[model samples]
Target: MKILLLLLTVSVVMAQAQAPHIDSSYSDGQIQAFLKDGFERNDRLLQAKAYYLLAAREQNGGINNEYTITYLQKSHELFAASRDAYHLHRAKLALALSYVDQKTFDQAFDLQREALTYFEQRNDLFMATHAAASLANTYKLMGNLPQERVYLERCETNNKLLKDNILSLAILNSKVVNFQRQRQYDQALSAAHQLLTIARASKKTNFEIAGLFFEGILHQFKGQYQTAIGKLFDCLSLISNPNLSPEAMQCYLHLSQCYEALHDYPHAYQYSQRYGQASHAILNNQRQTALQRQTLRFDAEGKRRQIANLEKEKREAEQTALWQRTITIGIGIAAFVLFCALFSVLYFHRQKTRSDQIIENQKEEIKQKEINELRQELTLQNVQAIVTGQETERERIAKDLHDSLGGMLSTVRLRFDALKTGQPTHAYEQALDMLDNTIREVRHIAHNLQPDALLQFGLTAAINDLVNRTHSPATPDINFQTYGQEFALTPTQSLTIFRIIQELLYNAIKHAKASEILVQLNWQTPSLMILVEDDGVGYDTTQIQTGMGTKNIQTRVAYLNAHLEVQSVPDEGTTVVVTVGV
Candidate 1:
């Protein structure tokens, strides 16, 4: 009975000690007690997260890097279990920044790019912008100004629409520094002013301080020694020491530049020494971290050998598995071939009928092209006749203007000059208004003769203006829409598209008396498709002999190496679709 009681008591104590921990029990004492027992455990993931949370709180501004890095490294190791792209990206970004803060610029730059690639592939623009900003800082620290500018521009491009106010202003500030580095005083000062404006407009403290420091640095670069010193002093007074790393480093460097230029040897030497000390400390920290990495790498190498041996054994086992999979796939392929052989009998019968239709289609296309060429010849002749008639009409108008309006305008101007210089007469004003109206009318006629705006502005804008002006208030509705990316085209291509739309719309409104029109330009697969649709009297396409308008369109389409399709009904509507490689 005594032995039984002792055994029972020991078993109860062991069971109590092995009790599972219940997370989120809302008991701080229990958590502290649990942590006090051991910092490490069998569950690496749990231990890593715990150490991470603790190290984050214990960093206290990175005063003790030994403890901080140890925890970060452990957290990094356990992150492999997550094996997610975003998690890896986050860990790599954090490690890179830590490297940057420690002044390990080369390694920081390399790792930052790796993080950036993952963000870019996922189209996570916000994180990409942040990564680019960090990359810019790393490049600048390494004295690679051009590379730094490239990264800053990327940051700006990504955040242009996001309106991450602080980041946007920082990008501008970085560009100003780049300009100053190149000794572009006027441009640099302008950029600096722009940065200050952006930062103030954003109403962010960090951005505002960044702007002010950069503004002062601009003055220092411009040889305004005393002004630069005062501004730098103002910046220093404005920010607390804890918020001082980036700006303070800049201040020291710029002041050293200013003092050395002004021949203040002692002050220059003192600042140079200060810079050396700060830089040396940063470098020493990096060296220690590198040594730690090297030690980890040596340890990892031994682990890698062990892993290789295990992998060899695993691979040997996998070979037989792979062979079995291959055999299974071979059987699937053989079965697929049998099914295909049975399918081919029906497929061949269908293909024979399709081949006949394809040949007929080709013949029809060739005939259409020949017909189009003949119609274009006739349209060219018509255009020549129209031009000749217009010129004669214009000559008649010019002769009238020279003989009639010229004399009247000369007489009126002479009479007006007879009056006092500042005197106004209602009669005179009325006569002037009359003359202005006539001049405007004449200009309108000339514009109808030849449109310069159509030539200067793009095809779409020109067509839109034409539709607005020509469409009567009581006339049928005209809807115009566009899609795909717009880019600069050669003047001739623009003119051709404009002319085609004008001719098509004119034919629809005048000949067909169309009640409605829909003009659409869009990307259809790899080519651009322009469709003009109207509801009006439609002709049988069987009467395929091309008219003048049809000929002009066909000519333009040929010039563009495009395809055109026309579908029409007797009373429903006519739709014209043209596809061009654009």
Candidate 2:
């Protein structure tokens, strides 16, 4: 179970570490706007950069993969057209990587080699080292271990000269992969160990996990089934989300194989089943990605056709205008004047019609805007009313339970104690104990109905109390921390925040099955940030977006006009960050 749990998170780490760094300072809309601005200003360089940025963004998100490649190609063209050699080579490198991802090794190899030569010629070791590493990876994928080794050697030399730990790690990873492919188990194992040491020293858990995985593979290839199982399980133990990790799938498959070799049918079957599920999930993801790329391709093609048609129409209109001018030049002055007068009348008539249409459209738009605003206001009011009513009812119930039922239970316990003291009977003592339990249960219910600490102490104290109440040996340990000076909040805001945190905690404990949870509050000058994180079996955010819990949280978030970001990967855990204007 521990092995499987660790395997689950491997994807999360690998997914983070594997992606190229992308600038997210500007949004997709902003980038597109910049692209438009560049076109309008006849700035090819700006347009090229925008296209590259868009491609990088798409690559990072794994969206529109085919369109991303197209964007990179266009960016490369624009850079070359603008005589930007450096950017052109950079774009070529991006394009090559994209081709590698798509398994088009021929194109990838050519482009990568070109970019590599450019960087090497300039003695740009930083870029050259990465280019060599990428080329090696491409060769590795193509089953050309000799070529891969050649590039790996180059990468090693460059890294040695530069003394870059990151570059060294990349080189080591490449060597491990190449050695494994070459069936040099001893060399591969050594490289894996070195990789693991460097990864651990650098605190790169993802690389460490990768090294462990490679070690297990090497051991398995050497026919050390038990040793391989141990190493594979070690790899799995480090991962958080096995279902999403290809490494996890490999781990499961190898574990199954190892168990089968050991004649452990039950364990083998269990791992085989896990491997099947992981494979199915991965296949589905691949299919979805392919479909998205295909859709983007279709959309791009359609837009291209539309642009072509529009340009054709513009050209035809220009030709007609030229013909009209040439005919008018040959016509008499009276005929030309009469034609101009007729054209002016028709144009004015069309202009008046367009103006009327525009006026009506504007009026309709204003009406719709007003309706939307009114609807939103009503929704807010309704939510506020419902919450206010629920709190009021909760308060009433808590008061009744505490002051009425609680008092009665306590009184009964006292009377039973007094009677027991007089009689000194076992029956009376048992009744007294029962009364004590009843009294405690009533108080517990009352406390839950409406926490007095929240009403008296503020958000910080209330959260602490919640953490204390939620924590137990059977539940995930809750860690509560606050930073910055505390700020005051209205009763509603305080309650809403508390409820949001409470729901998050419940989800983490009950659904996530986490071992640990962290709740943080940071009160800044204008905004308060609340973060709830858990190291639990996470869920697919896309799949769970419309869940009731999510909807409820979103509603509360809307009420506060707050920004909420939820990042989760299967088996890795979930992190929810909410930023609210104070």
Candidate 1 lDDT, 447-560, residue by residue in tens? 544455766777667778777766877666788888876566666566667767877887788767677888887855567778989998887888857888888788777766
Q: How well does each candidate superpose onto the true structure, as a TM-score? A: 0.36, 0.46
Residue 227's C-alpha lDDT in candidate 1?
A: 88
Each model's C-alpha lDDT?
A: 0.67, 0.81
Q: Clashing pairs in model 1? A: none
Give the candidate number with the greatest lDDT.
Answer: 2
Write candidate 2's Cα lDDT for 112-228 as tens digits.
888889989998887787677778778777888999899889877877888866566667877887888788889889989999999899998888898899988788888899999
Error of 2 at 508 (Å): 99
